[model samples]
Target: MFAVAADDCAPSDPTLTVQAYTVNPQTERVKMYWQKANGEAWGTLHALLADINSQGQVQMAMNGGIYDESYAPLGLYIENGQQKVALNLASGEGNFFIRPGGVFYVAGDKVGIVRLDAFKTSKEIQFAVQSGPLLMENGVINPRIHPNVASRKIRNGVGINKHDQRRCLLIHTGYDEERRVFAEPAGDKFL
Candidate 1:
């Protein structure tokens, strides 16, 4: 819910942005924070009171939207000039390993998504996250997704405006099929 940006940050800068979300399991409340890299303070963004089940666990949290089990990213993760988890090329389990799962990255003044194979050889990535079944690729919805599929779940994805690298988009599709959700631009919205 919170987003941070440096006063005069650019993509080439290592400390461009940071976003954090704290989820309280006991209270089922989620708080978001955003701050610029090296900033003195974090700004509160959103405090969401999530619905909990009888067991005191969030009933319908968005899975795969944030951290995965063990608090590790479900796909490739890169930060602070280091690759946290190598690009996953093998088809294993989960949506993350879906064939052709792609990487969303920021480098210099550019924001883009490329197939994992291509990302492995790239030398300019500054930050990145890998996610599967790309909702869209090269300006088109992935052919793998069909409109009539019976199975539907809350889903989220990132997109960058090809015309302007600085303008990025975060899309969250809730369980309801009739409504569309779009988020405003944030420093690390793609992440």
Candidate 2:
């Protein structure tokens, strides 16, 4: 796998802070979680990290998918090759229902982003999470998204490395733990 130079990823807007980590399915242990084995929901990232750390697995964690009132994933959620929740294709308010929403998945040592209509189940898929508006695919941004739209909030997405198909970047923007705004919403361009 190849690593892109940091200069290539420098955000256009200096004020919009982006934190990213490179993940390769073959070298790193990537898993999705929403609850404990005891049937209690891990309602927040802090709670999930604490639980994992208590078991001596102190590692980075993030919550980028949408969840409902009970914290259950609103779309497809899989764990260790088992589907926990089926894909969601219903009409709804907000970003989840945007046309051509997609799934981010890990299959064996590879990762992929595919439009919901194009998603398929396979034995090779180790983990998957459905979320979107399928921002961009194959170097093209989804046409449904406005280029200069003012609507913004804390958001995150996975991007495949152009240099290495197996490598993916977990990207996030907006406020930090202390509630400081990193990516201002009013900017003309993306952070």
Candidate 3:
């Protein structure tokens, strides 16, 4: 996964930040990178193939998934024991306010997705981000999201197996223009 950010300077300005993570869940290995905007090339931050273990699990993780016009998180965002952005309670427009939008959170060794209301009362949350009308809930696709929605857009989300807490799923959907259909779900493991 990759993330890039730039300051509000002119196009010719050289103030940017880029981060990339290469994760191999099957081998439990991770690689990271950092690059500045001065035309400097990417630099490895964690050159070693880091293992994901109880004693050395990832210290922090961010969605870097989606955002809004103002570049603010379009959904819920929590970091370092603080709610950086409150659970969105307003309604009307946008994908985030769709009924049943959920929040993904990590607390201790546990990771979960819960409805926004449930999140308000949740305890011990270490990191969190809210996004979307759930893509799936209780093993079923969210009723509000239809396969033939007006627009076909790329989407991504996180899910956890109800019977296996250790197994988390990251899903990304893209359209195969040639086939005129969404591509098969790409699944990735978390930690």
Candidate 4:
């Protein structure tokens, strides 16, 4: 489910450019290399996980990141054994439908999408463990975890339906209850 692909170039030289790709299956491990872009053969990049992914996501901070109540809009590049960077970012909310092959789409942010051909529409639904704050139930919106629906810090809210559908919704309001929507504008309207 996780992988990285980059141009064959010197790491110390930024000009040796590489736009990380996440679709390569061979880059799943901590260290790997490719004979060419889109090549069928891959060599080795390194021998240790610590040397490559020691700092976790390349663009992520060592102390604060997606975990432990920290988050950001920037896509975190988590590397495996090689310096292969994969986009590790959060997902958008609203009207999400996972296709039979695990293709997922949100209400917005369609310009760039990642597809995973693993989800089955016939897969059995199951309950999932939750963390952080609960947004609302019926009419009660709990703030103990998020404190306010308008908090820019909490971009999404977690919830569970009566039928047990674990959901995460985009918070349209700010911590002050003001109409402060996030996500990029799709065509003309902000999502």
Tens-place lDDT per residue, model 4, 108-135, is 1111112233222221211111122223
> By TM-score, who's the top model here?
2
RMSD of 4: 15.9
Please give each candidate's TM-score: 0.55, 0.78, 0.57, 0.21
Candidate 1 lDDT: 0.46
* Candidate 2: pairs in clash: none
| lDDT, residue 49, model 2 | 68
- For every candidate, C-alpha RMSD to the true structure in Å: 12.7, 6.7, 11.9, 15.9
- Evaluated against the true structure, the overall lDDT of model 3 is 0.47
Per-residue lDDT value at 68 in model 2: 87
The parts of candidate 1 lying over 4 Å away from their true place are 1-68, 121-124, 150-152, 177-191
lDDT of 2 by residue, 81-168 (tens): 9998999999988878887888888787788888889999999997889886766655555677765554557667667766777777
Query: What local distance difference test score does each model get?
Result: 0.46, 0.67, 0.47, 0.23
Highest lDDT, which number?
2
* Candidate 3 lDDT over residue span 31-121, tens digit each: 1122233433232223211322235444222333346644466656665466656777678676766777787766655667787777763
> Model 4 — TM-score against the truth?
0.21
Ranking by TM-score: 2, 3, 1, 4
Please say which candidate is ahead in lDDT: 1 or 3: 3
Q: Write candidate 1's Cα lDDT for 51-72 as tens digits.
A: 1133433322222223453455
